[model samples]
Target: MSAPAPPSSSSSSSSSSGLVLQGADDVEDCVWENEGEGSLPWDRFGYVSDLVRNGNRAFRQHRLEFFEKAVSYYTRANQIKPNDPVILGNRCATYIRISQFLKLRSASDSEDRPLSGLDPTIHAELALKDAEKLVDIQCNSVRSFVLKASALLLLEKYDTARDTVISGLQVDPFSNSLQGALQQLEKIHASCTGSRSNTKPERTDDFDCTLCLKLLYEPITTPCGHSFCRSCLFQSMDRGNKCPLCRTVLFISPRTSAVSVTLNNIIQKNFPEEYAERKSEHDSLTNLGGDLMPLFVMDIVIPCQKYPLHIFEPRYRLMVRRIMEGNRRMGMVGIDPLTGSFAEFACEVEVTECEPLPDGRFFIEVEGRRRFRIIRSRDQDGYRVAEVEWVQDVEFPQGSRERVDLLELTSNVAEHASSWLTRARQAAQQDRAKYEKLLSLEHMMPTPRDPERFSFWLATLTKRRPDEKLDLLRMTDTRERISRGLIYLRAEEQGCRLQ
Candidate 1:
């Protein structure tokens, strides 16, 4: 085949391919010349040559549609001769051109008639994929590196694009295209950094999450292009799956979505003090100090007990969502019948499992952890939050007479409890589900070495009144708790109900 004619000035004026191949003056220069053409069957060679000619001609036309046509023709050529370096490179360049055109076109240009095709990002991503394959197949080609770097640049990956150009320069230190790309990348990067550094600090709604009315911390940008603090967005999303700003129906959840790192860095770097303050405020809620916790006002819970809770109220649903995001722990407290207020003592529970329903409710399983004595209480966003002191049994020194006696007492009580459960399991065997539940509870028993925890586990073997559980939470004497656990077991064995 004869060498294709050099591109003319007239063709350049009407060319769409020039958008991506701006450094190259002619399309013929972009295509490798006569490398493997002789090896191809004549009929297949003629057909591929025709396809390439048509693609080159289509891209030289002054229409985006024609640019797409060029890509389609190159794609067919590629399918016929898989891994043809020339065809891949041409198709990759065409995709980059389409992406660049779409991205640079003014909104006003398409305001009247929306362009019906893949968006800029998708095109750029396609270009990047092809460019990557070209790099893998033609590792030594400067053009492959240039194409990949260009696609990455259009995708806004400046650092990676800069690195790609640098690597290409290492391959051919005298290549002007790579040198120019390196310079262009440095200038763009410097300008972006300089612009951010030079801009005056301004406090505006632009940096605040609409949901929280505060400086955005760990901001997440939705697919709809709206940004919010990650926690604030999910809190609002817990109530409804819609962008709080534009109400665009959101398909992302906190579990799947990630913080917008660039936007977050911009905000944090620009407004350091405000960002720090916002972070501290957020930490206060999510990581309350050792003595403080958000409280769930419901039934009493004792340590070493496990149960499921249905969170339906808006306040508790909000609390559950936050807890799941944070440490997955909260205080479970009940009202004091005498004072008609939250009980002074409560148990801390960790959410072991959580399932958020579509209707803004949570089905959660929690395991009681430790006890706390509320030193002060307050309302937070319609739920109870308390400053408390963690409660634990007063321990006798190890190897002391008191500790030895306590351990012996615990072993005796454990034996009694085991025998009682065996009988209870036998009695409940007629009901398969009840027997299974007892078996599960039996498996959860703690060792007598952890007498305090074992006492609570024993107490759970039988259903107790709310006030009785409250008393258990308040007791700091492990031996006393164990004695009470034994009494409860015996009472149940004797068919006596404690009111």
Candidate 2:
């Protein structure tokens, strides 16, 4: 056996130096042994650590006291670490986790539900916003991004989440967890889009396909118990990774035959009126020509994959509905603090599916195909109207489709990705069910142009100061992203450059 290597300088600031605390699952008693004195960076960390320790104990008894301790701990931590981005961010996290615990428990237990009259949806929305703020504050680490992304996902903010994660990786490309996460995001998008089946089954007019003008055949009823023709549901899953029907966990496989038949008949028979109402609601949301929006609201943006729109503000619901009325959708632009509070860069969203809720709200869905930047926004009476120009996709240089190999890079990153891909394909050949979920995971891999992998590899170049993570976050181009990765790969032990 070879001699043990020296510890990396980057890891010199080990919180528990004498004893190794490699992962979260390692419940070693000796962890605190080395953390005896002056180890923690801030007082809040110490306080939270104590709370976490006590919380663990309370959790053993499954007591309510445990969560309350955690809440108070985080609350105190947040108070001290207010302007500290990480602390502020983590405070948001603690609150979200707390709210989620309460929300989920409330969902399961009818009588035990709190009498506070707080809407879980509102609480969920707030939690997601806090996560978004952490991202805004640039305190979003890859791990924090993952956590925020989860909350956004739970809140059905799919486009917001995909955009956020992409931004995170641009900063710290060497994060394996983020890469794995982006992979998961892509699968979820695919699953959302995959709901559109080839054979349009008979149902209400709204469920019918626009392309073939036929009813959706091979109706896919997801685990959440919502059925759509296979095709329409495909990319929606990518946006949110949840069942489009009932917003539950959707596997990337087709439901059983018997189940499909049962769903089809049940939807047609028992839910026919409900389906028709939903369809009619969908048609009412469309705008064939001029905008029919309120004077106060300006533009409505249903965000898309690559659009740079900073969609915020609660009043935008009216804006979205107005856009739905005439334009069938509206432009979404990115917020530029220097230029304007509203979005300066944006894209047009073409409304595809609009499902109305019982409370008269619309579950409006749209797809973004291209990008545009608004040059000017003027008050059109009460509504906001803008002079906008298109941003061609061709303006951004894309790698040639000619076969390019990242074999050398893959050679270093443990081959976990490619090996999994191969196994997935093989599994597809053997068991269709297993293959789809595996394939779902595989499908999320970034295309060669995606700098995420390079970003992750670059992160390893040399663990610079924690400040370096910020520079990584701000990087905008692919070449730099890869260069950073290569620097680490070269500096890493005994690695070769394939390029």
Candidate 3:
């Protein structure tokens, strides 16, 4: 028997009936009479014919259960005659029929009566597989291309489906079914394109990040031409440096690859409300609140200090990327020696410069900003996030005797700190690294007018222990902190003289 003709359209119900076994009632008898002339045994041929007949009969019933039964019967027939184009075509058609029926069924009907079998997408996938095999078996046949196109269309692969229809027309240019399918595909494609060009394009996958399934925020288009939200792309790259959509090996890093400004502007301009919502969601992750911050459990950082950090661990790399995208600030905490966990008090630091290395590491320079005491902390995406209360030094009233004394003390300490740093730099003139460090410290000095910040800058002039730095962060008495800073500077100067 010849393969069935292609369906007139993907949505046509007649596609299912197009594959009915020709003279199925008499197929067994015909097989029996021609047994001697054919290769198959008489009994097996008859059995295969009967299976095909039963599948056709069930398929004609036009019910989901009957379609499933048709698939079963056709599957058994195909197994008996492994390469039978007729059997493959009939099964492929049945699968497409079931998929179309399921898709066209009213939402209310689906909600009222739940389905338990394979879903529409799965059926289309199965149909596509069968259609592929049929094409391989009969390359010159228009029916094969038609079946493949029908399956592709059902799966929403419009481009490939259109190509398949064109290929079918090449095989049989006069085939009415293939011609009709090509026209239908063109209309569908035109409708989709027209809809997107409207003044306010509908919220479709065109503007969505496949990874987040939301409107794109800070969309970063890859070299392969796929776009994703900046955070989503890098977060995925943390696992492996490849494009999530195409799996192309990505050479771009967060620091180097900038956002697609044009695409981002289009999304923002077209869908203002949705874009605002996406921005709000993204901001919530980056900046939790005024008092809440993500913490980097590393070392103690005092205000007015600058340091370079190498972020290699996956969790930290993720955190640093988010920070760079957000406010470029995070709390830096060190382990508490006694508790062996994150310290109670930490200093906020702002990322001054960030360089993303090729091996997925970050070389970053950060400067300390302010201090905060962690009230409560929790884990977020493999990092610690804390609710904190900002720490500030108690200020004496202006022009008061106590305030004047404090100001005098601050000025004296600043002079002593500056003298100590000049001497330290001279002593370290032979050591290039140490000399450079002293110069950097010199640049970080804050004026005595802001005594709290000046105190921290003074402490940075000398290499102090982490505990001492933490104590300085905890100290609210500006005069005492300045005095302690002066003591640290004097001790370092004395040690340098001895050396």
Best-matching candidate per lDDT = 1
What TM-score does candidate 1 get on C-alpha atoms? 0.57
Model 2 misplaced regions, further than 4 Å: 1-65, 76-81, 99-120, 198-499
lDDT of 3: 0.73
Candidate 1 has its poorest 10 consecutive residues by lDDT at 1-10
Whole-model lDDT, candidate 2?
Answer: 0.43
> Candidate 2's residue-wise lDDT over 151-259, tens digit each?
5654445566667668778878877656655666676567554555456445466555443345544466554555665434532432444565556643232211112
Per-residue accuracy of model 3 over 121-151 as CA lDDT, tens digit each: 5567668888899899888987788888877
Span of ten consecutive residues with least summed lDDT in model 2:
18-27
Give the range where candidate 3 is weakest over 10 consecutive residues by summed lDDT.
Answer: 20-29
What are the per-model C-alpha RMSD values against the true structure? 19.4, 21.8, 27.9
lDDT of 1 by residue, 1-499 (tens): 1112223444432133222434422233233443553244454456567888889887777357777788877865654465677887877777776666665554445344435523565467667878888889888988888888878877767788889888888889998888877877787678666645577667789888887788888887776788888777756766777778888765445333345657776888889988889888877787877877999988888987887899988788778867765788999988887788889999999986454554556678899999999999888988988999988899999999999999999998888888877777677768755754665576577889999999899899878888899999989899999999888888887887521
Deviation in angstroms for 248 in model 2? 22
Cα deviation of 229, candidate 2, in Å: 22
Instruction: Kindly indicate the candidate among 1 and 3 with the higher lDDT.
Output: 1
For model 1, the stretches where C-alpha displacement exceeds 4 angstroms are 1-205, 238-241, 251-256, 426-432, 496-499
